[model samples]
Target: MKSKYYIITIVNVITMTIICFYFYEQNKLIEVTTNNDTRPIELLKKIVIDSNDKSAYNELRDAYLNEQYHEEVLFYSLLMANITHYRQAYFDFYYLLKYADRSQEMKIFDNETRLLMIEYLKKGAALKHEQSMHELGDLYMEGKYVPKDTILGKKLINSIGL
Candidate 1:
């Protein structure tokens, strides 16, 4: 029947649309982290063997940064923070997350990423990291990601003598 053929055509169109959307998203992520440079294979192998290896993380982050692969650098920074709880790594990761592109995973992690970034700032503040305290205070004042707590923000600012 003509109706049956029409239904099949509609189904095919929908399937094609889904396939196109998938490839489009993949292409977008690649475009966001575009690079013709080679990956640090040896460092990656070292990281695989020892996730807590700060040396490998530093090397990887530096290499990616030198190649202008900011997203990769951000990933390495986050890993360093998670692995070693380094104060500066936490700060770097938090700031980097702010400017991160939403070309990742259908953008589902955008809000989640912001929440994680706020948590990093909070940790950095707890560690008495001055820059983190200053930045978190401003974030609280502006309510950029966390809930607006002007009192807490002022206290943080004062604590840092800023």
Candidate 2:
């Protein structure tokens, strides 16, 4: 109930922010403050006061996202993935891990992080997360990380009608 409103409010705020940015870009007279620190601290305090506040947590995650705090985003995203067990959360993890830096030894991620990413994806897929299945399947098909199994990739993708 409350969460739905929070989501809508967040969406509205994001949409306005985007519109403001576009206008600011063209006019060069207005200054956009996407990097404002006021929001994160307030949200953090709210979270500290009540750790179970999902709305605060969600807003804090979005704040981290807006601030481009990758590790913080990843941490909250991992928690969300574990807590919600939803396709969107798993997709967040997948999207972050996909863009993570690789080692000079041709590793997609550091060994532990890579394994963790794979483990999360596998669990998400087993739980029938559509995005997880699609991304894991894509990984298999790409043959970049882990063993390449086109058959398995196709199977996973096809399982989701992708």
Candidate 3:
């Protein structure tokens, strides 16, 4: 009877220790995450590698968005487009739209990336950027940004005339 009691006590203590350790580790992770460090990007990379970690994915995406990491935003957007096509990818797509450099534009690609490209062109047009107007006209002419509507493309090109 004494041995049974001792074994039960040991098991109870071991279980409590494990639970406490888990909480402690979890709390530590929270602390690390809250700190303004680039480690969150690393964590995001890990979550990308393990698609099963949905919570981690959300956290990492939020962190990257907050940090304004354009490349990371583009990557996650494309990844989501490829895997799930979730609406959140649109938010990342918008981020990329606002920040992507012109030199990097060629790399911004996916089946659904046209929507983002069109948004960028519109933004440029709104800002009166002649280059964007020309690009948009060309894309329209070539059926890149939208279905080829030669009439509309010619109209845009003639309006821009460049």
Candidate 4:
């Protein structure tokens, strides 16, 4: 009778440990699925369907930023700008201007787009984005986008220790 009781207790302990470990692993799997299931293109389509979804915009922005999607970053930045989401707009625009090629292939080099890019760059510079400040300073020094303002350009460059 004593031996049977001991065997039963040992079996119960093993079963409980296995059950606890199984549940813990299931919880981890759920967490991973939740993190990885959100796709950027799907979020973009959702944004297109309902442009007022702020959370979707934020999620798409974060996802695309993580993926290093430059054109999508520019698109979302401009969209945010149109909605007056200035902080996110500035961040996204700064990244786009800092990393993207402003040629025809990127479809962002037209005169109007160039002006818009400069506008966002100036706003980003005002927010103290170092790269935007540097790029805008270079543009001003070279008269590439806005009218030449060498004084402001030099001022910006000096501010960044470059």
The sequence of per-residue lDDT tens digits that candidate 3 reaches over residues 69-157 is 44554555545543654445534444455355344746544433445446545555545555555656677789864788777677766
How does candidate 3 score on lDDT? 0.54
Clashes of each: 0, 0, 0, 0
Number of colliding residue pairs in model 2: 0
lDDT (10s digit) by residue, model 4, range 60-116: 656656654445545556556556545556656645654554433655444544455
Tens digit of per-residue lDDT, candidate 2, span 1-162: 989756754554354335434543454322223244455444553463346454555565566566555445455555566566654556666566555554234544455455556766787788888888888899899985669999999999999996
RMSD values, in order shown: 12.9, 14.0, 19.7, 24.2
Q: Candidates 3 and 4: which is better by TM-score?
A: 4
Residue 65 deviation, candidate 1, in Å? 3.7
In candidate 4, position 78 carries an lDDT of 59
What do the candidate models score in CA lDDT, each in turn? 0.64, 0.60, 0.54, 0.60
Write down the worst ten-residue block by lDDT for model 3. Answer: 26-35
Number of the top TM-score candidate: 1
Order candidates by TM-score, high to low: 1, 2, 4, 3
